[model samples]
Target: MATPAADLANWIPRLLATWRAARRTQRRGGPRPPLDALLPDELREVAAAVTRLSTGLTRERELAGARYLDDERLLGAYLLFYWPISYLQARGVLSELPRLPRTVLDLGSGPGPLAFAALDAGAVAVTACDRAKQALTAARDLARLAGARLTTRDWNPTQGTPLASLTGGTPPDLITLGHVINELWKGEGAEEKRAALLESAARALAPGGSLVVIEPALRDTSRGLLRVRDLLVSRGFAVRAPCLFRGACPALLKESDWCHAERAIDPPPLVAQIGKAAGLRKEAVKMSYLVLAPPGEPWAAPPPGVVLRIVSEPLAGKGRLRYMGCGPDGRKGLALQEKHVGDANRRFETLKRGDVVALEGTEPRGDGLALGAGSRVTVLAEAGRPVPMPVDGQA
Candidate 1:
């Protein structure tokens, strides 16, 4: 199977060719502006609209009817700008899984970006569901052009249909909800609707299967996903990534903070232009995501005795590097200072949030954990690992 990056490299050029051809045909016999020339201003407008939708400042229904969705130029700008971000996000989530899924069901799959990602990740068959016919049509066209094994369905989860029923009797090995929960939050009975949708997705998961949900890293959306995390735990699903414990979320306990992850992505040329025009930062993509498997199902687990999973970016101070993380016990902080560890500081400095590390000789500090100079700090997993660490310090 091809890696997501390879698959994206092949798919993007074809989509661009199609988009350009469509543009030329739309303006046949007229002086048509260069796609690059028209992209910056159009991308700025789409970026602002996307921000509004993600922040709940504007409703999806209104945005759907607005020119952003209705106008072809704006829609094209959005697809081009968002394609790499979505692909990178999907690659990040799929990399944590123990193995490639045989089948995938992508819910609320706008333009089927994630479905394509799953296909690239070795899912033999992918089913994409969305409410918008136009989005489905675009997905179908892209899938056809790419010769990918994709099927499309027009269904709205808000209508109370069981997701499993839509997939026939064959349960999917992986289910993805990408940026869909935030839109669901806007309707009446949002809580009930979200719970029902999740429950259905869980029920539809095959044994040893996983359900992954991704949302914007905004305060509200991230907090909302935290709530979803707690709800899934309560329903007996085991979290598989970005969390070291199944206990209560530490970030949610705080009023002003939320748990989210960030990864750097190299934007495509047009996306870079749009970022410059809109003053948007294109270096890092931040999001809140959860991966859950049914209880008793086998998936990747952290190395033994590696209790704390760094959940925040490493904070570098004058002489020490501080890590805020979660453990099976609860939320804890750890500090690795240069003066104490000497040359070992270089190794510890390489550690980032989401890496699992064991503090060999540490004791509890105020709301955090402390490591002494004599302590052996070993990285158990750079991200999430399925294998155990060596007992000796040599690893």
Candidate 2:
């Protein structure tokens, strides 16, 4: 069977072709703009429009009332450019779970790209909720084209209702808030609204169920997620990834930095065209995310000596590689000298964010780990690998 990524790679082009044909037919005698002909100025205008929609502390009613959500040109641009990025983000997060969710509830599910990703990742059913009827309609159309199982519901998350109530009494195994938290942050009493939403979502988790929240990698958004992480831990939820212990985030201690992860994605052709036209480089997807389960159902503990999860990009120095990471004990910095790791030095150099590594002869330093010349380094799993659901510490 094709993986979710493979299925999407196959489905997007066909959808784009159909949309292009519809445009041609509608234009009649007039020449239609090529599907990928987003000019540099137009790209910047779109980017500015998106930022306007996103940056405020409250939803920009004027912008929302604009055809931003319903305009065919804008929607097509988003489907061709932004949808792939969101799809990759969803795929990366879902792929890390111990098992595929049988049912998913995607909140603020604009155009339902994430819902499609969940269905492709083996979800039997998906409930996508959004306030924008236009977005939900587009999502429904896309689902039909893709032949996926998805149901749409009208919801405004800012109202702070228990998400399970919207699911008709059948709680989902996975609940996702993708790129929604920041939007919630735009209103008055933002923190309270977020708290209410999270509290309600936590209450909705079934046995072994998980909640995954993803946001943009902006400094404020990343810090906000860290605060949310602390909140979840205080509420007795077990954080499954990115964090190894229930402590204050170490990355936040430095006033100049924030914690986030990066995942590379191969862009579709249309995305490449948009990138070229916009003078934007299509690189790795960067975001801050949290995965949590009910308290008693914590993720499997790491193997002996494999304590730290490298949560940031590795820093390369003269002869050593420095990793900032979180461990079972707390957040710590780990250093590996080129001579000490020997052959594994190459692998160490290539390690991406979110890798689980085992280090030998390491002792805690101020707020990190110190390695000696004889210390050994081993990678248990690279970033984005589907961690096995271990039973009693055994997989």
Candidate 3:
């Protein structure tokens, strides 16, 4: 039998190596390298660590019926990259804008990443508020380092009231609700919190101000998302087209699902698009961004096209792979491209693995017609492999 000392000796080097790899990946301006790249001997141990962290997160939320601000630490090494990854998706809309907000309010700004994003986008004032003092402290320290001012508040979702203390006794020019809304809706105190947040954001929004609420698109039936979406719409906010949050759907895409043991990765090009798909145009003060708006403004609209599921053909051509996929509307075809590209864009090349071809043409070839040429599509990967359909069900 292996003695404890022997086991420790055997694992320490691998553990240290993995940790160093994670740290390096964090600082490299990208996402955590695929979980597999960690040394194989260390993978099982790291996987266990990931499982423990995931379990802790779920269990704490399930037990407490609310989020623990400290749990945000689970994202410590990763939070750095997560911001830029998200920014890449939103930049398309933001970059075309003529200006950024002079004053910005980031609700539930744990660690203040969003606050900094707003500032980087040229906001004059970035006020980040969160209920967790520890999280606020971290945010403050970072803000100080960046030479940006931060105002923290004791705003709890359960409070069901605005942090009236820091509303400046007036509305804010821009407000951002990032990831905190869903946390507010997970249990007994949810409805009140949701109502309060919605009402507060609406009432405190400057006449021509905009409110951006972003969250992971993890809800089934888009119920929680739709509730807030509808509430905003009813309050006169318009829904923007192409659900802003589009990307890979994790195995835990649903609210209560949990994974056990070593399961296959849900696969890629797994791109989970998560962002605010719609922003209400406050019309009066006249934001210049409205000029670049795509036809419909402040309206509830679905994304332009359906997601396409692509199955990997690792045996295909040199330096490339073969893929077969179907749109969310159920049209199927084959895609020839690098396995790394996670979404369906015009750049994907034309090739074949069978009858399916990545040629320039409509899907379903006039027979099923799910997606037309030029439709925006996402390609999700499963267990590091791509498939042609959403195995978990419709996306």
What lDDT does each candidate get?
Answer: 0.71, 0.71, 0.42
Give the deviation of candidate 2 from the true structure as CA RMSD.
3.9
Clashing pairs in 1: none
TM-score sort, best first:
1, 2, 3
In candidate 1, how many Å is residue 302 off?
4.3
Residues 47-101, candidate 1: write the lDDT tens digits: 6644554333223345532324334554465466666677778878888886678
Q: How accurate is candidate 2 locally (lDDT)?
A: 0.71
The residue-level lDDT of candidate 3 at 202 comes to: 54
Candidate 3: lDDT of 199? 59
Distance (Å) between predicted and true CA of 188, model 3? Answer: 7.0
Provide the TM-score for each candidate, comma-separated.
0.86, 0.86, 0.49
Report the lDDT tens digits of candidate 2 across residue range 73-183.
Answer: 555555666677788888888888877899889998878778888888889989999877767877887787777778999887656455666788987888898877766
Q: Model 1, stretches more than 4 Å misplaced?
A: 1-3, 18-25, 29-74, 187-189, 295-302, 384-395
Q: Ranking under lDDT, best-scoring first? A: 2, 1, 3
Candidate 3 local Cα displacement, residue 201, angstroms: 0.2
Worst 10 contiguous positions by lDDT, candidate 1: 386-395
TM-score for predicted model 3 compared with the true structure: 0.49
The local lDDT score (0 to 100) that residue 394 gets in candidate 2 is 65
